[model samples]
Target: MPTRIVVDPITRIEGHLRIEVVLEGNKITDALSSGTLFRGIEKIVENRDPRDVWAFVQRICGVCTHIHAIASVRAVEDALDYRIPKNANYIRNIMTLTQFVQDHVIHFYHLHGFDWIDVVSALKADPAQTSALAQSISGWPLSSAGYFRDVQTKVKTLVESGQLGIFANAYWGHPAYRLPPEANLMGVAHYLEALNWQKEIAKVHAVFGGKNPHPNYLVGGMASAININGNNTINIERLNLVKTKIEEAQTFVDQVLMPDILAIANFYKKDLYGGGVRNYLAYGGVPTVDVRNPDSYLFPGGIVLDRDLSKVYDIDLKDPKHIQEFVTHSWYRYDDPQAGLHPWQGRTEAQYDGPKPPYENLDENKRYSWIKTPRWQGKPMEVGPLARFIIGYARGNQRMRTLVDDALKKLDLPLSALFSTLGRTLARALETKYSVDHLAGFHADLVANIKAGDSAVFNPDKWDPSTWPATAQGVGYCEAPRGALAHWIKINKGKVESYQAVVPTTWNASPRDAQGQIGPYEASLLDTPLANPDQPLELLRTIHSFDPCLACATHLLNREGEEMLNLRVI
Candidate 1:
């Protein structure tokens, strides 16, 4: 008999997530990904002014606040055929890039690093050997023996004190952990350093967006006003501050994050697992001067099926036949469970009539998750840094190719390895380095635009609802830190009639479709070797690689004010 393991409320992520795996002896034979909570932000936006939609949608996820705001505004702009100033685009790019840097670094070192580096193992490391390993990887200034000694001492104190804080309840010293004690120590030291580094980088968003989390965004342009001498406006002083922060973030990515990823990859080179859903999808982002042109996007959008890089299929979000969401196995009632509806025609009627929680196993034939299955051309697709990198590489993106090729060469791995769990983690680090390095150029462009006397930010022409048609619809999309995110809206008489968001996690964490095709999370766990069913460290390593964000995927609340279910972590 296959042993079933349930890990509810997967720790170290943004929102509630549960993973149920069936192990045939030591290998996973089946898996189920569940999103436990739901907050219906889509219904909340209904009957609201289109201009105010971004503010409400920004609350979708605290971690991915800016991306939702950006996507929301883009959808509105697309409906009105509005054009923002070039300076506005540049400022928006800088703010979004800063968020990406902050998010990716935090995800790697703080959230996902624990899976690879055992904090308890770090206590056994020789500070001198750790220092040598760190120095060998990069010329990071803090790679001194004394510096590592301090980190080791700190870990020892945390462990001996029996108060591990963030390191608590972790599968420490698990057999799945492959990093040496010295490597673990080095990672832990950098992990602490990242906490400080992220604070400085966050200032970039505040300087431009007026706040860090849930920054202010205007539909026609950015919220920041341009004035060379006024204290209230985004003056030269504020621009310089943003520049300095971007440079600081770049230095950390280059000297610390990138090198650390390569070092960790070296240790787990042979452990190939978690290459889920080879079909990749990316809605191109980081627009240059033109937001409408897909070709000019820094991250081009396309669909790659069956891991074939030679041909990339173009995706048109407006086409009802292209992108659709199916609630076949989700806790929602659609007009037809088998029929996939595009976001424009999407419905979010909650029907939690499935087997109640507190049950041991989910009936796969019935609804098991709150996340609806989002398919591109009726096929499950994986998104995120890995998808973006692969699509960029396939499209002859020289920078992406160069960065990926260089990393692969360093790890002594082939291009094929980019499909595995390690590759997904490494792609985020690579994209961070790329984003940080190019941020200066974007900043320079913004400065040039301002100096050339193009100081306008927000265009108030479309602020009035009377200017809009009786009905208009548009799709706004951008690649969030997790993956491709889009917000679809239909405005009737300047008020939102219908709104839907197909987030990144929805693409990766969906349950089985009507065809019984497993989603990325389920497919990835199949055949994964488990060291200990009780301590499923290997399972986490694969899932965390995608940096799951369940809060953004399923956002609804129970109005009954009753505890629907409880998770017992074992």
Candidate 2:
């Protein structure tokens, strides 16, 4: 008999997620991922001004807030055929890269680190040994015995006081944890350090976007105006502040984040459990000098099927035959449940007729999740750092290829290892290093352009809706920290006719399709071994590797402001 395990409201993530796995003995035979809440953001943005869509969409997820704004503005600009100023492009790039640095670091140290590091076990670590381990990895300034000792004492106090606060509710002494006490202590110390580091990193976003969580964005250009002398505009002092913050972020990545990931990877080199769907997709992000050209994108977009890197296919988001969403096993009412509709024609009418919540097992044959299956050319695709890394490595990108090769060499692992759970986590760390290293160059270019007297930021020509055609449609896409994200918008007489956002988690956390094909999250759980079915730490390791952000995936709320679906742990 297959033992069923249900983990509701998976903690430490952005939003509510419930994972159900049918385990035969100790290995997972099947799995189901459910996004329990729905915010109806697509419906809220309807009949609104097209220029202001980014502001509304930016609230989809607090963690992925800025990317939503960026994608929204890009979609509107695409429809208007608006070409923004070069300075605006550079400024946007800088902001995007800063978000990447802050998000990836936080994800690794805070969100996903607990999956590996045992906080309770850290209480037994020798601070001297932890310092030695840290020193062996890198010459980080904070790798001192005193620092590790203080971290160990703090953990001891938390454990003794029986109030871990943020460290509470974790599977602290799980058998799946492989790191030693010293390594766990090091991870915990860096975990606390990253909290302080991220605060400073957020200042970079405020410098350009006017706020941190949901920043201001303009369709034609960035919100910040370039003026070297004026106090009212983005003056020289503000630009210098941006430069200093970029340097601080870069130093942290080089000295702390990258080294810590490599150290953790060394401990779990042989554990190869979480290799999900091999088919990968990425809508290129971080545009270069030309925002319109895909070839100039820092992260190239393409589809790789069956892990075959040699044959990458170009994806046109506008092509109806390329990208489509299917709701056969989701709580959505489409004209045809089995049919896949392109985003421009997507609908979000809810139909929650599946099994009610507080149930033991999900009828996988029926609707199981609120997330619709998003397929690229009718195939399930994995997106995020792993996908971006694989796509970039396949495209012969020198910087990406070098980063992956060097990391693999350091770990003494073969290229095939990049397909496993550890590979996915390591990919995020490597990408962070690459993103932070390029921040200085982006800032320098922005300074040069501003000094050259190109102070233009916004284009007022298309700011009015009367200039638009009778009907216009466009797709705005960029790689969010989690994976590929795109917003499709349809406008008529200057008002939003239809707005659909196909987010990263929509692809990763989707359910089975009409043909009974499992999505990435479901497929990844097959054959995963469990040390303890009650704890299910091994399961979270794989799922968190994808960095699931359900806040952007499903968002339908009731009048009382409670989650409509009740998740019961059984």
Candidate 3:
């Protein structure tokens, strides 16, 4: 008999998620990923002005704020067949790259770091030995023995008082945690350092977009103005401030983040799991010339299936047959339960067919999750850093190929090792470093464009409602920090008729489709061996690698007589 285990409201992720797995002995034989909340942000933006969609849709997730706004604006622009200025494109690219660097670092240290790191063990680490270990890894300025001693003292205070705060509710002494006390101490030190450093880097978003979390964006272009001599606008001093922040971010990635990843990865080289589906997708990031041209993207877009590097398929976002969403195992209703609908014709009718609250198990044979199953050409695909890296390496991008090769060489691991849970984690760190290296070039280009007397940021040619066509539709996409994200829109009489956003987590956390194929999260967990079934630390290690954000994956739905169900799992 297989043991059924439920880890509801998965902690440290963005929103409510329940993961149910069936364990035969110590091995996971099957898994189900559930998004308990209803995601209906599309219904919220219905019949609104196309220009204002960016602001409303951006509120989907606080962590992934800017990307939604970018995608929404691009969708509106695409519908109108409008083109933005080069400077606006550069500014948008800069904002995105900055977000990637900041988001990835925060995910590794604060959100996903605890999975592999044992914070309690840091209390027993020798400060001198930890300092030596930290120094051996990188040239970080705060690697003195006294500094390590201070960090250890802090952790001791938290543990002794029984108020671990952010460090609470973790499987601290689990057998799966393999890092030594010294390495754990080093990780804890940087964890706090990253907490302090995160806010400063966010100032870049403020400098460009006016605020963090919910940054202001314009449909035609950016809302920020450029006047080199003006203090109120994006002038010389502000641009220089942006430059300084980028440089600081690059330094931190090189010295602190990369070294820590390498060190932690070295300890768990052989504990490989969570490589799912082996079908990768990236919608190309960081546009150099324009978003329309795939050739100019920093991370080129393509699809690689079954771990094949020989052939990469071209993706068309507008083609109906290319991408479709199925709700066969989802909590929504369609006229035909087995039919898959594209975003332009996607429906969001609320229908609950699962078990009531306090239920021990979900009817997986029926509907189980609020997340829709998104398939590329009728096949499940994994998206994110690993996908981007695999696609880039397959396409023979010299920089991407060289970076992945060097990292594998340092770890003495083969290229095949990159498809596991560790590979997803390593890909994110590597992509962060890669993004930082390109940050300077974008900054330089921005400065040069401003100096060349092109200060235009917004394109007002088609800004008026009178200039719009009676009916139009478009798709906007971005390779967000998590993976590929896009928003599809249909407009009529200058108002949104239909709106749908197929986010990154939806792709990775989706349930089985009409064809009965499990999603990336479920597929990855199959055959994974759990040392102890009671404490599912190994499940977390693989799931967190995708950096699951349910807030973005599942939006809210308002229905009369519908009571919100909140489950407290003890």
Candidate 4:
């Protein structure tokens, strides 16, 4: 019998999600996105001094909190037209990069690697071969032939460390697993090494942020003290190790990571070729080093679609009328569910009419998700590596096609094999490689500039809220680890009068809209045939590719009903 199979609380990703798969004889016919928890973030911000908003709002997502902090501070500064100093600008860039590295490394190895190699498989791996491979990989340490062996020892210690907090709910073994025991052992060793490298980078964040999961950076400037002899005198030797780490990481990508991607990808080729939207979007990545002109970002803005993987279009985020938050098929009580209301004024309430049947279509004029349907220029779009790659490729950037083509050849994959779970994972690793190499030179240049005596930090004294300024709005957009992320803010009386955000995962996991159009997750699930409806591991594999964060996804387990519905139909 054809029946609906929904994978509730989708694993691997950061957030909570339930895949609502409409089945008809082995194929999924439809889907719905549900962001089941609602935290009164905007409500919490109301009636508070504007200065504290950065601290509170940044807690929205542990992974991309830096971007949120940057966006919030920029919006407030824009409202007041408070121009910062040059030193402050550079400091922000360095700290933001630290956050980026911390996020990317942990996510790639610790979270994604477990799927390919089973824990038990590691027990059988040849330690000698592992050492040889580490020697060959540029970034991996091999000074002590004993280093690789030592890594295995640490993995055992970590397992017994009682800090399995990292893998508390993780699925170590699934039916789909298939790696040689040797490879599994090698992965186990690298997993421990990766964890160490992640902490190494995290210390960089700790030096500046006070903590890793969440940090402290003020709206006016940073909290850390930069030791500039006068103004432009920077502490070079102090930051050189970080520079070397970036270099080492680049080497690993070119040798170990990319090679492994090709090998593992060869096996998952079939899984690599589905769930592509062809519509790609990027939320203008982080700003460049030059403080004078920010439009020139380390990563720029634009959108690309199936027709051309080469050309990108500028996205104007400041257009209030161009954005919206729809709640039609969702479970909420609002007068105009389809209205383009700013986030601070937007309402959020969980009042499901009933458990929406998995296969049936809801009202054509309402929403079925707690996630607001955010349309860029009013259109559905996919964001993340594919989008970023398309934009960079269209611009004829050097590394774009080269990496994609090389990966395709290594995996023995055809041209049509992109945008699935494996591809997403590979794209992330590849991007980290590129960013590491790119930043190495920039960091060097920063050192040179500092030695020349130019440290610019802050240039503000005090201002009255009553006389702050007129109404001014700006949108800060950047690519979070998962995908394109954006923050839309409007300021009044020097406070966060209004704020709205559209994160990357939201793009992939949106719910049904008024027209019954499936959100990205729903759309991706349509063509994936569930082999065994009772055990939807394939469904889990696809969702985990995005690495979503349920904590930041605006959901909660209702202790009242003992109900934990992270995703549900309105």
Candidate 5:
């Protein structure tokens, strides 16, 4: 008989996620991914001004903040055919790059690092040996014996005090953790360092968007005012501040993050599990020119099926056949459960037909999740860093190919190694390094544009509702830190008639569709071996690789039609 293991509300992620697996002997024979919370952002934005939808939808996930706003505004702009100035595009790109640098680093260290690193194991490390390990990897300037000792002391206090705090409740000493004590200590030290350094990156968003974790975005372009001479606007000092932050991000990625990724990946090279679905998708972002032109995207957009790199299929957001959502095994209703509806025609009618809360098990044959299954041409696709890199490499983007090839060479692994959990982790770090390298060039371009007296960031030509057609619909797409994301909007007489968001997590964490096709998370768990069923650390390793964000995946719509605010999903 297969043993059922349920891990509800998976910790260290941005929102609520539940994973259940059936263990036959030591291998996972089946798995189910569930999003416990519901997001009602789409319902909240209905009948509202299309321009104001960004502010509402940006609240989908606090961690993935600005990407939602960017998608929202881009959808509205696409509907109205509005084009932003060069400076505005540059600023948005800079902000996005900063997010990539910050989010990826934070995800690797604070969220996913715990899977491979044992905080308790770090206590056994000799501070001197840890320093040697850290110094051997990179010149991060914080590899002193005393520094390791100090960081170890902090952990010791937490351990001895019986209050592990953020380091609490983990499966320490798990057999799956492959890092040695010294490497673990080094990683733990960087974890603490990252907690402090992440604040600096947030300042970049603040300098441009006026706030962090829900920055302001405009319909046409951005809300930031570019005036190098003005104190109130994006002045010379602000631009310099942005420059310094980007530099700090680059230094941290090159010296600390990448080295740590490479060092840790070396240990888990053979643990090549969790490849999941072979299909991948990337909407692509960081526009060098206009957002509408996919060719100008720094990360090229396309699809790769069955791990094939020879052919990259073009994705059309407006085409009903390209992208569609299904609620076959989800807690939602459609006239025909088997039919997949495109975003413009997507519905969010909540229908909880599964087991109630506090139940011991969910019927996998029925609706068990709140997240909708998103498919490209009826096929489930993996999204995020791994997909972007795969598509980019397939497209022969020189920089992307060089980065991936060099990383593969360093690991002494073949390109086929990229189809595993470790590959997902490596791809994120590489993407961060690549994006950070471009931040300077983007800042330089912004400076040049402003110097040339092109400081306009907003387009008021279509600011009025009357400027919009009586009925219009458009799709805004971008690659968020997690993966490919898009918003579909239908505006009627300047008011939003319908709005749908097919977020990254929806594509990855989605449950089985009508055809009984398993989504990425579920598929990834297939045939994965478990060293200890009680600990289940191997499960965390694979799931965390995708950096799941359940809040972004499942959105709620009250059947009673009441305004939903301050509803907590414990």
Candidate 6:
């Protein structure tokens, strides 16, 4: 008899989840990843206007809402063939850069730290001792004695702010805590620093967004405008402030963030050789509509396989027919399994598509699932920080390459550094630092263009549905913090006929391999033992690493207490 593994409602990330591992005595033989919470977002947006998608999709992710809104607008613009002003592109990039900074800081201290390090570690830490350490490596700010008192007040506000999420449970003495005390203290101080870092960086978005959490981004060109000092064409002071902040943040990235990642990995040397996949992908980051004719766009999208970490083999995203979705055992319904469909034209029917005689078999095809397995080039792939890290590392540009190489060396190994909790946690930080350091150069060029008075605002009309003579389709794939993600949109009747979105977690936390082979999560659990049958830390480690967000995914609505047309076999 196979052993049954049970994990009921894993906590602390974005959504609800259940885990079951089939164990043969002491070892796991199989795994089942259950995404039990389903919010019917697709049906909610059916009759809404194309523009309202920004607000609707923003609700999908509490942390990365701004990106969702921007991506939606980008896709809609792509369908309408609208050309945005270059100024709009610059503003959009800055907004995204803010989100990236804040998201990176939060990921480092709030989300990933709770699992391995203790919150109370800072409480026991000597203020003088940590301050001295900081000054030694990152001096001046704490050069005075009074500054130490100020730091204490800052730390108090963060821990007591109650805004960083419910992390009191993640403190040093917590029952599940693992890392040594000093490391916890070190991470906690960074936690406070990160909170300040994100809030400050958020100003960039606030200037354009009206506010954070969910910002205002108008579709088909630009919404926010740059104004002069009430008497000029531009607010040179404010713009320069933003420019300065980018540089200041970059300095922090170089001096502190990268070094911290290296220091932390030094303690967890085992992560370098676990769960690595030779395959990689990127949804071609940033826009490349001409400023530089290098053809090597900002984030060149493609599929990468191991043979050398440097070369990435990209798949053309312009070809919609080449991409397809399979909802085999998922809670979706389609007439055929090989349905070459994207989200815009996709359907989510909760009924089982397979024939079944009873409930015991639990055949995936005959079951209702909250998640739909997404495939690229007919196979599932990993995305997010690791994929982005690898892809950017392959680019081997200045800052990204330096930060990544240092991290790789710290893990005491090479390329295989992707698969475990440490890799997942550290990759985002590396990417964050890289972007902060690089976007400055991009901003400088934008300002130089403005100083030269280029007046390069390329805004076009909102969007004329009738004038859209082309019916061609495309998919926009981009790497999010979690993993590989893409949006598939099909336009018809001057409206969105079908829209499909496949997120990073959809690839990483996926249930099973298409041929019924165990997935990465399941495979990782093969030999791991649980301390108690009930509290499976191993399972939680893998799931949380994906940073599961329930709202981001689309699920079927339940009638009363069950799926409307659930099928079962016994």
Which residue pairs overlap in candidate 5's backbone?
Answer: 38-556, 39-555, 39-556, 384-483
lDDT winner between 2 and 5, please give it.
5
- Where is model 1 more than 4 Å wrong at Cα? 557-570
Each candidate's number of clashing pairs is 6, 5, 2, 24, 4, 27
Alpha carbon deviation, residue 449, candidate 1 (Å): 1.1
* Per-candidate local distance difference test: 0.90, 0.89, 0.91, 0.61, 0.91, 0.61
Clashing residue pairs in candidate 3 (N, C-alpha, C atoms within 3 angstroms): 39-554, 39-555
lDDT of 4 by residue, 1-570 (tens): 667665665655665565666688866676666665555465456455666777877888767777677766776665566666555666567666665555666765676666666675455556777666545544445424466567566656656775655545544555566666555666665566666666666655564566676777665666655564423223454466557666665665566565565555656677652464666777656566542353666655577765365467766556555455556666655576566554435555555663454544443344445565655655667776666766666666667678777777777775456666677767766676666666665566556666677544555543456666656565555666667766656666656666666667767676665555566666666677666667665666666666766555563223232333444433
When summed lDDT is taken over every stretch of 10 residues in candidate 1, the lowest stretch is 556-565
Global Cα RMSD, each model: 1.9, 2.0, 1.5, 4.9, 1.5, 5.1
TM-score of each: 0.97, 0.97, 0.98, 0.84, 0.98, 0.83
Runs of candidate 4 with Cα error greater than 4 angstroms are 24-27, 124-139, 142-175, 229-237, 244-256, 289-295, 340-368, 461-467, 555-570
- Tens-place lDDT per residue, model 5, 1-570, is 889999987888978888999999999999999988886889999999998999999998889899999999999888889888887899899888889999999999999999989999999999999998888889999999999999999999999999999999999999899999999999999999999999998999999899998988888878898778887999999989988988998899999999999999999999999999999999888899988777899999999999989999999989999999999899888999889999989998887777656678888899988899999999999999999999999999999999989988999999999999999999999999999999999999999888988889987888988766899998888889999999999999879999999999999999999899999999999999999999889999999999999889988877455533333433
The better candidate by TM-score, 1 or 3, is: 3
Q: Name the candidate, 3 or 4, with the larger TM-score value.
A: 3
Better of 3 and 6 by TM-score: 3
- Mark the 10 consecutive residues where model 6 has the least summed lDDT: 354-363
Task: For candidate 4, report its TM-score.
Answer: 0.84
